[model samples]
Target: MHQLSRRGLFTVAGVAALGSTGALLGASPANAAVPDSPRFDLSGAGDNPVAKKSLHANWVMQSFAYDNVHQHLYFAQVNTENSDRANAGDLWITKTDTEGNELGSMALHNFGHGVSIAVEPYDGSVYLWTEWMSSSSGFGTRIGRFAFADGTVLEKTSSAVQDRTPSIGDTMINPQPAIDPSTGRLLVRYKTGEDQPRIVAFDLADARAGRLATQHRLAERALPSRGAWGAANPFQGFTAYGRYAYLLEGRAGGPSYISVVDLNGTGQSTVVDRWETTAGQSLPGREPQGMAVWMHPTGPRLAFGFHSNTGGVRQASVFVKTQFV
Candidate 1:
């Protein structure tokens, strides 16, 4: 892995790949001319075969998180065969310096489908959420708490059925979890309907005591389509900044977007802004999935993880917006 400055991450080739529409350079219409609104920049991009046999599997990046305390970029990935229950797979956590240099990596067995990662600001502890199934009739979910020092699992919990919503036939697919830096509240979101998702906020105290606090409905516009391959769930990724929560919509080989919701005094969510990628400038064959936001030395940036397949290789591209609301 190579370390590059935020600006250097966007090479001429990357810019060309994104097209000349300059869609990523524009600001959201709802926001005023805030000095640092939100702008997209390529942080780093590459592809590698996920490790096999536990050494270095060719893993496909699924989710991302930024550790402000330690200033590290954390990514969660799952190997190809491990995505589904057909073959056993492993989940990997790759930690890199702010500049994208690999510092350390860890692999957890019998776990694949790494969906999301979040870092606790107070203690720099890492939290990862993953999904697994043993057979066509069986499914389960797990949340692993790891030490930032060595990626060792300090605590782990699992459920044969987690966050089930029978009304919509959804069972915590791609659950996005984040810890509010200001309040230390653990927020986890999962899709319950075509466009409606539920967000649950757990007090740190209650979480440590194995109890979930309460959940609320996230109000957002209807998705353009059901989803890639006709899947009903449309939400792909999520992160929290201040009192607002941002969600990414998954549209394979189509336009990309991020929905901004205001978590104000009422504790009710209102769709305040919907940012879409430029029509002709979107990633040709990629679907945006995961998102993470943190204040950088230069400014606040929004990072996204896009998944794609090229030449039989599963790839993940990390893109960032240095100036984001």
Candidate 2:
């Protein structure tokens, strides 16, 4: 089975074929729950199908994460286009057995826009980041707290206090969220500035207390490319390993490199080492969209997933055991 791309997982056209937009958001009436079974073994290698055989739906899956506590994997979808009175598809959370069999599932409210997911142990609870449509400025983005188990957002409202927009041509991409275990605060660094665009971090607690503190920002020289299309990693896609953060930035035309930041202090980011995704070629096709990065459970190895343009079809890509050195 072919892997799905980050953006392709929720195409406007794809949602229409899936039935009602509500279905796409995970709004299904209760029914007999499917028993849990180990469906896919991550330790091994192969495709991990998000949906079941009976539901063979071509959902363009964007967000992906596994809850260590509940042992559940979560991902979300949105409308291919605005229809069915739903602007975006709903967020879906599924619990699977060790064999990856569908055990039970639940759907959250419609975001009206796409949503991103990231999980981290914080203050005896899990931290998450989601983007929901905001009417504050008539258009804005919300990044707040959510309950890990049932996907209930603890942040009550979509406040526009810290909202920032990208440039005209560039769009805000997936934000790789991480939490500082030491501080018990959620931390995130995203890029959206027009010139010398940067990745900045803040303590969720501070933002909640109305402080909105910024830890640090990535320097211009550290970026992949300085030109319009020569930007690094198309999105603010990144991964974290032991006090360090690994990020991928792609310039417009081609050339993508990784930036490593030390979180030992106020999360100061520095480009320790740099390498292109492909040695000599330019990054191919529509800016290689969404990305996921994380550290291997055992070693300094890093894990990542990216969008690949395979013959004009966007597919999800997997790169494992990427050494930190």
Candidate 3:
């Protein structure tokens, strides 16, 4: 993993401000028809409509989860450290209200790099997916569960990687867990090559028990096009609402988009919607990372966390939006 640093300057813009000239693609049997991208209109919500906030500079926002039951936004931050050495950094999980009010926080010592987070609505338990390196275990990833009320770790289950040769240089990209709100089934994305990423489903019972579950590949249409932006756009973060799964694509300083798909029991996924962030829609020169969704008084709202460097200061920020039906 690369450390956060001050880099080039990129102007920030709004997704809603940019109008679409034509549809990128239409929906099919496995994909939903393309819909107009969500507009970042602050007028409807009144002044100070967009809830923007900054996190500590030492922390890099990796993933996010929202607890609808408790109305809390959970942010997973990984302490920045050199990845070449066995010395791993701690992981901090912070909770805040919908208005960006700080509620509480929990710190895990040498807990590895937190990649993503999800909250179980039924039991209010928080799950954090992490990757780390150790002398004995080599490179590994695990899913950790914590109590939502007190931030107490309940259990952790290692995600076994097949034929994974662990090394200091080995880096893996895993999307944050996508929980099915209706069934509480957790969906995790994993890929090793150029092919479409695989989706693994673990029941809440199995996850709480620390058991491994079945894995399957998402439908081809469900996967993002590799050369969409002159490079392979890997899945950066994930969230699920109703029967659809939302995927974050592209990297910081580049064009980014969100792909929504209908997930099925047979592992086949149907693309429903795709919203690309207009150039300059995010924090200047920052890349969008983890995302979470929740219900607002006006309607359902989506929140995305970003990492960027401005004025020689490396910072983490979040932008929330609504009006994207």
The candidate maximizing TM-score is 3
Question: Model 3, range 66-94, lDDT digits (tens) per residue?
Answer: 77667777776654544433335455566
Superposed Cα deviation of residue 295, candidate 3 (Å)? 3.4
- Residue lDDT tens for model 1, 1-325: 2221221211211101112221111123211211222333322232221211111234556676777667777776665442334334345567777655678765544443556667654443554434433223222243444454444321123332233211212344434566554445566665434434455455554554445422222211112223343353356677765556676765677766676654431222345434664422334457665777755666566666776655545555666665432
Q: Candidate 3 at residue 311, lDDT?
A: 58
Which residue pairs does candidate 1 place in steric collision? Answer: 38-323, 38-324, 49-58, 50-57, 50-58, 50-59, 51-56, 51-57, 51-58, 52-57
Steric clash pairs (candidate 3): 13-280, 16-39, 27-32, 27-33, 30-270, 31-271, 32-271, 32-272, 252-287
**Model 3 TM-score?**
0.62
Q: What overall lDDT, based on C-alpha atoms, would model 3 receive against the true structure?
A: 0.48
lDDT of each: 0.48, 0.36, 0.48
- For candidate 2, the per-residue lDDT at 163 reads 36
Q: What is the lDDT of residue 22 in candidate 3?
A: 14
Error of 2 at 98 (Å): 9.5
| Model 3 alpha-carbon drift over 4 Å, by segment | 1-52, 80-84, 109-112, 121-140, 148-175, 192-195, 202-206, 210-212, 215-234, 265-274, 279-282, 297-299, 312-316, 320-325
**What tens-digit string does per-residue lDDT give for candidate 2 at 197-293?**
2333334455444344222211111122235534433443554443455555664345556555544322223536454454223223423222333
**Residue 14, candidate 2: C-alpha displacement in angstroms:** 4.5
lDDT of 2: 0.36
- Give residue 24's error in model 2 in angstroms: 42
